[model samples]
Target: MITAPITLSQALDRVARERPQAQAFVAPGERHDWRAMREQSQRIARALHAAGVRHGDHVGVLLGNSGVWVQIFYACAMLGAVTVPVNTRFKTEELEFCLKQSNVKVLLTADIFLGIDFLELLTQVEPALASAGGLPGERLPCLRQVVVLGERCPAGAQAWDAFLAAGDAVDDAQLQACIEAVAPDDVLLIQYTSGTTSFPKGVMLTHANMLTNAWAVAQRIGVSADDRYFSIRPYFHVAGTTLSILVSLMTGCCLLTLPKFDVADALQMLDAERCTLTSGNDTIFLMLMGHPDFDRSRIHLRGGWAAAGPQVMQKIRDVMGVPGMCNAYGQSEASPNITLSSFDDPFSLRAAGWALPHPGMQVRIVDPGTGSPVPVGEAGEIQARGWSVMKGYYNMPEATARALGADGWLSTGDLGEMDADGRMRMVGRLKDMFRVGGENVAPAEVEEVLHAHPAVRMAQVVGVPDARLGEVPAAFVLLKDGQDSTAAELTAWCKSRCANYKVPRYVAVVDSFENIGMTGSSKVQKNKLRAHAVALFGLEQPA
Candidate 1:
């Protein structure tokens, strides 16, 4: 049974008391038990406090999926500090924006990643930080300290190990007492949105919010201690941290963490670890299916978690070796998950699963034109209300008011349908739908047919203005490494599978997509693609 406070540190203490020797996390050659995790968390908590971190203070984490990240997260929970995990993929300018916006006082990062010197990036951004109004004499004013995670600490940074060693062994009783003081409603983490439109908005989540979502997901998926979880999603994402780490911790399951996502490496890890549960976006699933050694019989589980088109789900199960897979629909504002398919519901494997145990969470499909609830089974805007909803966007009251209604429902900005069983079938984004010759066209429906093509690797659809039709659907396609297809050929292929009006009138083939940082979960930055499409094919004139 869950208890009050709902703090991560409290949960870890419970697990330590119940199952001290259980393997909590497994990395390359390192392993940690519940007892060790608790101890490390305490030590890190003492170090953070000694560094002057206080309740409600924001600490930034810019490291990868090392055990240290987990320790830092739990340590913050113990110290009542809020953690702001920045994506390591961010450029110097992007990092500067988040650092300033979050008002971060301390930064924990590695010296390098994939051979790129992060210290060099920090140096380049130092002047920008000063221009942004950092304090005098401090390289980064709001940033009081920098802890390096890797082999050697850079000249201006402190060593992570040295800081941990500087603190005395924390008293277990005192640590437990501190955990008891945290409230379930206290802001625990701030997950920045992908910022498809403009700058990212920080999604403020509380202990109760995340705990409820994780518990609901575990119940819906039937995850137990017997489940061996393997994940490549960056821990900075809510899916990796809340679902993978918190859920695993609560259920006493074994967690296998991969530093990064590589198709071959992911396949090998799943096989070696005998991973029974995994989750990812459509692109990652497609990449895994293309790997040579992907086989269902090796590590088949109840079902994997995903969020994509139904056709993509089917292909993953039939073509890849994964038979049991499910789709979940959510956003960062809702702690990342609101709906999930049951393992027994075979039909849901093809749809974006049913709403989970957040029975208090209300779902409504409203007509895009009138903002009225649509009839059952008809596609409309998906909105939600309940405990899972975030408190509000950090420091953006106007935007927050617009997103969350006075009655407390969140406008998800997604188009989907609720079936007879209350299951959700996501059609596309509301902004992605366009009208052509007075008929509504959903780009996702069109993209699904295009993805069925043998040579197609991925596809994105948008509407470009046309002189005759007002707006017409256009497709941006990516092909397999050595495969090729002409615009006419792909258009003809889609014509055979979809309505003529829904078929893309203009097609552009590209080798890869532009990098747009994702939210905690791996949802695409659709706004970026929309802008790119406008530039590539002039929105003012038809091709």
Candidate 2:
């Protein structure tokens, strides 16, 4: 079946026209019907176009996961502009790198978030933009304007409402025309991968790519208009952006959003809203388990089993009173989810599950050395071919080519085994990366965070063996001349900056790091570091 090319905004309009009085977006005390959301998105689109944003132009959204995030995403879709959502946890330097790399012309952000003033950071980075002044605004090179969301507009930033006043009101006809102009192959969003290095690579996702993934998820989760989706993941990530926001909009489901993840608050919302379907990374599941109000009676899954350890699963059933749970697996490069355990399968809760049977999506296990397909029940590299595969990394052709083969299959770089029953069990990563409590703790991502410490001159991170978690991050640091900071101090600093799981469990101060081998780019060889961590921490062999 050939699906029609429907831009995100068009999807919202359809829902509004069909379910005008139906509740759409819910957050705190705020609620918007489908019709209201559609009109607001149109107004925002007009406001964006008036600020000089156009088709294919990058519009940076640096806000948290709030109702405004949905507005910005749909508004950009309505205008055919590519949205670039930046991670809210990023430091000033990290934020600057993403903004400069994407060549974002317009930025929409909040004045303050998590006790940090984003406006002050923007001002500090403004002078550095002088090096690249070919774009319209010399002040920020490609950045021509900034829209401050919420009530207070920061100094040197334009009020969001003021910008909306200059543009003509947009109607359904205008939105429909814009949707007609948007081809399925057009780039929809530039999602930045949380790479370990100083710079992040933008994963270019096409409209078809995202739509296919969302459709697959809807099918797996049995999404419908009656489903209420609680969006706890950050909108900057694929899990929240495509799976939560885009999927809800496309499937005509109601979306409940949270600006931040708070276990107590989330439980209250789930109970009050009676959320039927909730999805997030493993960390979210763990957080839910920790809440005092966590009980199976509070949750109502449609047909899937909630994935967790047996003890956690029992708690969910006993406390929240949910019947079933299922495990899900995917990566940013795969537009997020490729496989989900089924509620009907006997081992569904134990395994990562099976790939959804979407059109043009294929999964195979191949021996890494010989590039030959591995037999069933044997571990090998997991490769996939699907409409959900990303178009490529933005402006990084070499990396793109290496990731996606000429045969159209994308090597996931993840090692897994397919059982006789066709269920896939992930073994480990072909790369040196490892997961810390379900989050992809790339040694590089942690190492970069360590290097940011004022007392540290250089640092390296690697996954070490853990008794409970499969692996935990460990760090080796070299202090600057005459500077001294205890391992506890450094670890505490990282905790303040990044997620808790990303903090190093063990730290050591080293005088020098032996350069065993260097890449063509002169980056330190991470394999050597991994080996050292294994030797020092005595990592256990995989059974």
Candidate 3:
């Protein structure tokens, strides 16, 4: 096996040298081979250097999933500059917060995507973009340059063509010096957390932290140069940048993606490209397999990884025909994966919702309250210590101190149990777990029972306030198309399968959580669901 690259730029160089003609990226209307990818990234790196971005500087990328996004990331890596991927779904306030908090110097963005005018949004945040040289504003003092990657470039921003042309004068020797100076320990990505409960914190991940984790994930899933990977993960999140993009690059596979996820479009691409590997959470898999256009025979899926429960894993293998699909668990701070089931593992073991920690990564479940190790088979907060842990949260010392301990263990804030066989089974997030009177209740256990029902397609459980019991499970469910089920019936279904306290006291059938509770990374935001449930049921809000 090839040794892992110390830096992302080195990874790109190695892949280009080894497989110059191999396909590296494919999106709608665009494609790049390994050699072309590296060259384009180097050109962009020169342009960025010409624009006054230097080592240790933060460059914010606000674009959709496209080749430009990948090029910008590699360009930043080549210069030892950190890439801060702003969520495309960000509103005015969110965009402003990310820019100011990260101290971004150069901003690369699309003019408009999905009908959201980012240039207009930036103007709203600073209001200076309306005039000449709009940047270097009072609101965003560090921001000096704005490069727009579309037809309409505002007065303060340079067009994509102009930005690339600026690099023509930069000599190869100067660019090579910058690339040579980049080390494994330099900060590569500042991935902001999803901010489910609070404001997002920028997780500072070094080149070594991300590249090493991607190499490990690729090995576990048995990825190779012959495979084509279809991933629906948004590029702004760590799941997209590290697991999907980096994994595909390291293995010399084509990374296929869509700017915006459409069920029909995704299905068509899978069949057209004959994609071999794919990755997603339960919701994405449900949408794909549950779609009216789903036909497993045409799509040549071999294997991939899923951050899902047993129900979803089983369906992906049996119904979706991805037998090599493995169960996975992690958060953004651990470069996104702490445990993953190997591709060659038996279906029974893979479907059991247990994931083995990657080699060199140490995982220990400890009591959330006491920090004491829990016995095997007992559930507790999962803590991981290894090279994969992020350096720290950028500019948030208190948050960093809370997340990373002095001894090197990074507290994941997730709960799980380790079996005697050393495989870990995720119970639920500690914040997501609620107490019913006195007994602890995991929402996943109840959701699993709900998933077993024939009519249910997807479900999310949250605790709502109760005067007598202190808290009780309230479930939001989406039913299968052409099927019918009521809230009372589903609650009764769960009552029969789950313990008394584990059963949801109420169930609300919803058509979708896309607008209400889903995050950019496709995770169900339970805090939002919990708030919605409290308001929907007229229950007293938790203090």
Candidate 4:
């Protein structure tokens, strides 16, 4: 029987007691067994306590995926402090917004990682931090201490060693008391949304919310203590926090961490470590399979999950030799996992992109216009209510009210369809849907058809202004290696496969959307694609 953990501290302690000597975390040159994980995280908790972090206090973690990140996360949990993860891809403005909005008291960051200098970025955010000796300025008044991990510690920031030693005087009994005070309903994380359409909002999640959701995912994926899980998801994202890190901790599985995603390094690590499970999006899976170094025989993967369409899911099973791969669907506000196909599910259902809702989550497809539940097999907005729903958006009551109803159902603002058996499949975002001479068209539905093309590797579609039709579909495509397709031919292919209104009126062949329309998590930014399409096609901006 799978007993769900209420608090993260309880989960950590349970796993530590059950698998004392088993490996819990593994990276290139580092390893932390279950016993060490408990000890190390407790030590960090002591240090954080000495730094004056208390229950409900917000602490920011600005580092890559490493043992240190895991230790810090658990330490904050031990103290009942909320963790606000700073995205590595954030610029000066974005980083400052996160720190200021979350009211972070202490920040732990790295000097340099993957050729990016975090110190330089921090200096841009606050010029006085370089000379104020960890003192806060007007811009960041709540920030009391800046802890630097690398050798080049700034003038005002505390060094890693000194920070760790600061809590040597803190007793174990005091730390235990703090841990005991933590409740299941206490907010543990304030995850920021990806901001594809608007400024990012902080999604407040409690211990019970994330822990139960992670347990559901682990159960569905058949995760066990013996499984070696390889995940390239960034630690800053909710998927990394709940699905990867928390899942491994709860299941006593060994988590394989990568500071950054590189095709060569990922391929080599998967083969060498004999990883049994993995996770990624459609773009990530495509990049791995398209790489010349990818050898199916060398890969020992048995099962995993993906946020992909039917075309990509089919390739993951048939081409990549992962027959147990399942399709996944969710957003940050739902603790990320609303529905996921079980590893034991039939391949046909998995390939068709059908997924069963997490055991405790209640899912409904509702009309975006009237808030009425849609019939099964009809497309509508996806809303969920249960243990996985977020508490609210932090400090944004109006936005919170808009997303969450009084009855506790969260309006996901995503388009999807459900079948008679309670299986769900994502269609597209409600905001991404475009009207074509009165007919509604979902870009995802059209993009899926484009993905079926032999030469097309990836496709992104947007609604561009048309004089005759108000708006029409425009597509940007990335072709497979050594393959060629013109705009006209691709348009013809889509025209033959889709309805007249659904087919893209204009198609542009592109080499890559790397920095142009991609997010840090590999999701396409449809809003940006729309802006780009207008400029490239010389379409007039809507009034």
Candidate 5:
């Protein structure tokens, strides 16, 4: 096995030198081999350097899944600059807040995508971008440049082509100096975890933290240079950047990226590329296998990965023919990989949502308040200690102190239980647990039961305020296309399968749930769901 690259720039350089002709990235209009990817990154590095971005400086990026996104990331590596991947779905307030909080010096964004003009949006967010030279102020003092990744750049933005051209004068010696100054332990990426709360915390992951976790994930999947992956996970998330993109680069595998997932298109791409591996959240897999045109015979899916309820993971393996699919679980703070179930694991272990822990990671199920280990087979907050743990939350010292302990264990804020066999099962998120008449209801457990219904494509359970019970479980469900089921019927199904109190008292069968309210890892924003449920039910907000 090739040793992991110490710095991300080294990963690009080493791969380019060793496999110059191997395909590194595959997209609809653009394809780059290892050498070409490295060269493009150099041009981007020059462009960024010319834009006045320097080592340790934060360069914010807002774009969809594209080759340009990958190019910008590596460009930051080439200059020891920090890459802050902003969620493309951000609105005016969120965009302004993230740029200001991260102290972004340069922002690389798309001119037009998904029918929204991003340059116009930026102007609305900062207002300073209305001029040829963006106004500097307390809100965005460090922000000096905004580079648009398209033609006809806005007044305050640099055109994509012009940005590349400006890099022509940057000498190799200057670039080398920047790259050499980087170390394995230096912060490489600041990935913000999207929360229902107004402010999202920027998780600071060093090169070592991300690369080591990526290496472990690659090892578990047994990826190789010969592998071809149909990648659809959003590039803004760690699931996309660290697991999918970094794994492809680490193993010299070819990755075909879909800017947005289309079931038919994804299937066609899988067959066209003869992809050996693919991965996404449970919802993505459900959409793929549940598609009317889905056929197991049409594609090559040797293996893949999923982080969902065990039943969903089982369906992914059984239905998609990737029987070797692994189960992964973690939060963004741990470079997003805590435990990954191996393909060779026993059905009991895999089904229980436990696999061998990633190397160098220490996990424990401790009482949330006492910080003491819970008895085996008992649920508690999961804590992690290792290289993968993020350094801290950027500019949020109080939040960081609350998250990470002086003992080096980072409280994951997730609830799980480890069995005597050393396998662990995720119960649910601590915050998502609701009590109906003083009985604890883990929303995930109920959602798992709801998923068992053949007609249910997606299900989210939230707590609604109650004058009598303090709170009652309410479900917002999305049914499969061309399938029919009513709230009454689904409520009956749940009541039949679970305890009386666990069954949702209220069910709303909606055409579609709010996808924006979900986190990148496919977790439902229960807080948002709860608020929606409360409003829909006309219940008074708890004082």
Candidate 6:
């Protein structure tokens, strides 16, 4: 009964036809209706084609959450050109790797956005872009052109106005031909996963994969055209693009986006837009509640969409006065949506980290050691096979093979168990587990106990190398404002709550986890945390 659009191009066209005058998206100082957006996308696609971007070509979009960013994404889809979302936080070396790996042909970028000048970075990455006769780099042989999304473009890059005008040379009929040529199974996006332990892998996802996932998520969250969806996360992240942005598009909701996440800025947008639903994690919600400007009277917040524990979700709903909560849990590889939670569900039926799999998705739990399904109510590695699953990792065949089993199931790596009611509860990732002596320890179990403490705001625990025990848990606690608690006191508190092996051997109360590295999705890079812990403790780790 639920028939979503087959491709991004088709979806945009359908929406534009049905609701041409409806508000599509709004940002800090810009707004676009469906008709305008569709026309803009068509013009951009024609310009890209004139610039020699053909089908299956990779077009890198290097910027924040702006109208131009969304325009370029749909433009690429119209031309059947793959959109390679380049992370703004990536350094020169990481940028080099992404460009070389993706073999991007065209780059649609901005001169400056989010306090970062992408044009400056592009010049540094490819110096020829600043000089006459921009030549391809030895490393990036496939890249042909760089389109800057502002005035005063660099030597090798085309200006935003000029690029738009270039489309005038091509007729609308020619652009329509390109749009009609695209297929649903064609790869539309290649999102690089946030690699915590190893190098990031580009996950190839088709329009079908994204559309289906967004449809299920939108339906479960009860999204509608009447709702104003708040998008706080970055456009580069899966949560931002597929979950929040595309979900809004699928449901015909007005997407209110911000370039960056600031407590004040978010509050202002929510108040101005009267946002009915907000999309973010626990960190964003906690900051919103704690901000000095936080006044419930000004903002009409009806609900929030986020992934967190039951206590936090309840706090987000009942305590924070943002009821009609929404929940989602999945990595980028599953077209990023595997499970969902509805706000209408009663608290008695809702357990922490439990989200019912979508009817279109097939979820299974199997023992890590054996390829057999575990008994119901028992924990095991979570696997998924369904419409939402990704095609595979782009240009990484062996990595793809390792993730997708021969049995047609994608090994999700996370450990979880299924309840009698058929809901899945993720316990912890297998890689996140550490052995304290001969006993195994899951950081989540310890972190859960720490979260229960009155003073502790949030916690991230990791395994640090120990000479005697081989590995012991190290805790990083972020306490609430005006709350006081010592590392010794927290350790004692955790000791009283959890098992000996699960208890953290040491605790470090930190000011900013951002001083350590973080993934684009706001997840703590535990590998970096472990290395930092080792250096802090003056301890050696296994190479």
**Lowest summed lDDT window (length 10), candidate 2:** 514-523
Residue-level lDDT tens digits of model 3 in 1-543: 235449898889989999999899999999899999999999999999999888999999999999989999999999999999999888898889999999999999999999999999998887766678577889899999889998888787788899899998898999999999999999999998898887899999999888889999999999999999999899999999999999987788999999988989999999998899999888899889778899989769988889888887888878888879988889999999999999998888788778788888899999999999999999899999988899999999999999999999999989999999899878788888899999899898888888878788888999999999999999999888888999889988987888999989988999899867678888789999998999899999656
Candidate 4 TM-score, C-alpha based: 0.97
Error of 1 at 167 (Å): 2.0
Which residue pairs of candidate 4 clash?
none
> TM-score per candidate, in order?
0.91, 0.76, 0.98, 0.97, 0.96, 0.96
RMSD of each: 3.1, 10.3, 1.2, 1.4, 1.8, 1.8
Q: Per-residue lDDT for 1-543 in model 2, tens only?
A: 126545565567778889988888899768988888888877888888777788899999988777778888888887788999988767778787888888898989888887778777776677432223322444457887777876766455687778888667655576557656777778889999765433678998877778767866776666788888886767888877888887777788898877777778888888789888776533355457545576656665543333233333443444445544556667778886767665454543433344443455678899878779989988788888877788888888998998899998888887777877666755556786678767776564566567556576566677777878888888888776667999899999889988989899988887655443322112345666666777776677556
Clashes of 4: 0
Off by over 4 Å in 3: 1-5
Against the true structure, whose TM-score is highest? 3
lDDT (tens digit, per residue) of candidate 1 on 1-543: 244437776677788898898888887778998789888888998888767788889999988787778889989988788999888777887787887788888788888987777777776766432233332224356877777788966555678888777656556675556667788889889988766667788889998888778877776667887787777778777887777778787787777877777677788888787788888888778767755667766655556677777767877777765666767778788887877776556654455445443556778899867779999889899888988899999988999998998999888888888877676767778766789999989888888898789888788887878899888888888787668899999999998898888889889997666453244345556666766777777676555
Model 5 gets an lDDT of 0.84
The lDDT values for all models are 0.77, 0.72, 0.90, 0.90, 0.84, 0.82
Candidate 1 lDDT trough over 10 residues, lowest sum = 128-137
**Model 2, C-alpha of 404: deviation from truth (Å):** 1.1
What's the lDDT for residue 478 in model 2? 70
Residue pairs in collision within model 3: none
Off by over 4 Å in 6: none
Instruction: Specify the poorest-scoring 10-residue window by lDDT in model 3.
Output: 1-10
Worst 10 residues of 5 by lDDT: 513-522
